[model samples]
Target: MTTYASGKIQTRWATLDDLPALKTLINRSIDALQVGFLSPEQIIASHAVMGLDTQLVEDGSYLVAEYDGVLAGCGGWSKRATLYGGDHSRDLRDPLLLDPERDPARIRAMYTDPDFTRKGIGRLLLQQCEQAAADNGFKTAELMATLSGEPLYIASGYHPLERVEAIGNGANVPLIRMQKILQP
Candidate 1:
């Protein structure tokens, strides 16, 4: 897990009430970064209902970054067994690419509010995910990163396996599958 040099960031478990703010963070991140990587319509529609927090509840793990007591970003992690759910995963083919039964943590729903970008909020949140996985007895954490999130994951010691392009709104949008292997 990569730790941030900055100390202004704080992370905590998210509650049900944080759903709305988390939604905004997800959508804003898409708007700021995905627009260029995807069509305007594809970006908007894919991120709209997909950002709803309820979709992530089954992941059984979530974390939020805060700046001055306000949410700056949120993400989720769970046991490695391809056990994941979200509006976005409903259509996933072979979603169980990773053995949820073997891997203790799968990271998903990562997003940092644009206003808080470059300030280490996303990095902190990712590190927090790694730590959470370790605390839960997992030796690795994985994520499928959006174009905008690739840099942060790369800088945080994540390695890319392959880039996959999917047909969304008739456009091919690329996503990277990454993982951070941790020592148990």
Candidate 2:
């Protein structure tokens, strides 16, 4: 837990019980922040491809940031092959376990509430995820970042690897793939 200008920010592993609030927070954050870069349809479509991945909660890797008792942000890192997707992904694939010795830990589903933007909540959650990943023996991290989220990832030392179109709801949404070397 940390204190910021907004209030007390607390982070903890998300549980299945956190799903309802997490989903609401994520969708709200995405809709509010991505409007400038994405169309309404595109944003709605993205939900099908990008939303809460319950598996993260099951793995105890998903985290939620609360500001004075309110959901402010959420994110997590995965030790599996799935890079990005939500519960509603069309092309369902088994989450292949990754070899932490060689594979990059995946940073997944990062979202910050609009009211808490720039208040350091996202950064705090990200730091926690990175530290946890490193502690698990991962040397590097990767993620598919929304345009609105690219800045935060870059500011945190992630470098762009490629720009790709994620097919969501029959629409092509531009997303950037980024990677970062985790420091010991």
Candidate 3:
């Protein structure tokens, strides 16, 4: 569909046809930005073996931003009976979402083309993820946000549940587990 942008752009629900391009864009972005944070092996494993293309295919939330029909950015989630923290007390305002058995949808992959960086594409993809989670009956959404993406997630309404050091490439990388309660 047509989208408003400085140039020709499109925003639409990702289909099977978009998977290959989306996967390539996500992998390229991660490799460019996450070299110090994620191991090369980890990056390849996550993107090649499992990512938005493979993981979010079965009843999971997935979206794409296209510039002149080229895949520019994407974000998505997958439902889980449990999450990292555990069930919110049915509260949107005061939620205690869990990581395990917490009725959450996991927001996993989000990426934008370097050429499209600083544009609103990332924000749009993130908001689309939230809406998809809510529509899928999730009371909340959660993600292990990267350092660069954390601020954007926070600005978009996600709150930090905990911050921990993740061992990657035999180095400690800070990871923030965050949640965003969705309105029913």
Candidate 4:
């Protein structure tokens, strides 16, 4: 738990009961923040292409942050091979468990409500994810960051690896792949 100007923030492992709230928070965050970086078609398509991966919840890797009793943020790290993408992604069919000794733990699906921006919710969630990943023997962390999210990840110690133009619903969406070595 933590407090900021926004209010008291609490985090917990996201459960099946939290799916609706998580979905709403994620879509709202993307809609509010992705403008100017992603086209409307791309945003709409990306929502379908990148909304809610149940695998994270099932694997106990997903978390939700709440501010004043409202869901403020959501994000997680994955032990599986999938790097990015939501439920509609074709790549989700094969969720091979990752070898943490070699493959970096994936920082996945981070979203914060517009009202809660810069209130420490994202940073807190990220810290928890990183610690959890390291505890699982991951030596590094990586994420496919949306343009709006790159700054946060960069500030949190991730460095850009490459620029990727991902295809979503026939639109090309630009994303940055970022990585960081976990502290032992």
Candidate 5:
């Protein structure tokens, strides 16, 4: 489903057809946006820690933001047990569904194209994900945020829940676990 169109930017559910572009956008975002916020080693580790969770696309929960038809950002909410990490992450994969009343919705794989930073793409994706989760009966949402992404999630009302690290290529990557109550 398509959501709010502000100027030339639009949001919609992502599909397998968009996978190639999404992968490119995600890699570019990780490469260009993680600088300063992450040590070079951490950035390398990030590649193993973050990426496209195709299940989100299959579940039809992932949303992509486009600026004049160019993919600018992507994110999604999930009912699955996994809290974060992409399909390729070395972490355990859990496809089990979560009960809306018992588990907070998982906000997975949020990324904004570096060229599109400060353009409201991330905010737009967050709004869409939160609203969709709420509509599906989830009362709260949680995400694993990179240092660079913490500011935006904080501004959007998510609070830190914990600090965790993902290890890859012998590099330690820090991540913040954050949550927010979804407004009814």
Candidate 6:
């Protein structure tokens, strides 16, 4: 766990118990934060592409950020083959474990509560995820960056490798594939 600035911020591994709150926060974040970055139709399609991946929680690899003891943000690194999207979004779920030496650890399901934006909650959760991945022997980390989240990923040392579209609900949402080498 980490604490910042007189205990205003804290971070810890997410548990199954956090699912309800996590779902609410994830939906809220997608609806509010994607406003300018996506067309109305694209935003609606985003719901089909982004959300909590229960596998992360089950793997004990997900982290949740808290501000004043309330959930502020969430994100986590994964050792599995899947790179992004909720379980409902994909039919061929790759549950295979990734080799840390070869596959980049996946940074999945990042979301910040709108009320907690600009409070470093995203940064806090991201830092934790990278560290956790490094500790597990991962040499690199990768994420599917939403149009609204690209800035943050770029600023955090991830470089864009490709721009792709997630197609669903008859709309296409743009996403950036980004990667970062973990500092030893």
Off by over 4 Å in 2: 1-7, 90-93
Q: Is candidate 1 or candidate 5 better by TM-score?
A: 5
Candidate 5 regions exceeding 4 Å error are: none
Off by over 4 Å in 4: 1-7
lDDT of 4 at 90: 62
* lDDT, candidate 4, 51-167, per-residue tens: 678889988899898888888999999998888877777664359999989999999999999989988999988988999999999999999899989988999999999998877
Clashes of each: 8, 0, 10, 0, 0, 0
Number of the top candidate by TM-score?
5
Backbone clash pairs for candidate 4 read: none
- Tens-digit lDDT string for candidate 2 (15-104): 899999999998888789998999988888788778888999999999888888888999999998889988888374349999989999
What does candidate 5's lDDT look like per residue over 1-184, in tens digits?
6677877889989989999999999999999999999988889889888999999999999999999888999999999988888889746468999999979999999999998899988998899899999999999999999999999999999999999988878999999999999997
C-alpha lDDT of all candidate models, in order: 0.67, 0.88, 0.64, 0.86, 0.91, 0.90
Per-residue lDDT tens digits for candidate 6, residues 1-184, read 4444324888888899999999999999999999999998998999898888999999999998889899999999999999999978775258889999999999999999999999888987888889889999999999999988999999999999999988879899999999999976
lDDT of 5 at 15: 86
Return model 2's CA RMSD, one decimal.
2.5
TM-score ranking of the models: 5, 6, 2, 4, 1, 3
lDDT of 1 at 87: 56
Q: What digit string (tens of lDDT, one per residue) describes model 3 on residues 1-184?
A: 4233434555776667777787678667866766666666655433332235343544435677887766788777666432222111122112234343356777766788766777778887777777767776778888877766788899988999999764443455566889888777
Model 5 compared with the native: what TM-score?
0.97
Model 1 lDDT vs. the true structure? 0.67
TM-scores, one per candidate: 0.79, 0.93, 0.71, 0.92, 0.97, 0.95
Query: Where does candidate 1 clash, by residue pair?
Result: 79-104, 80-100, 80-103, 80-104, 81-99, 81-100, 81-101, 82-100
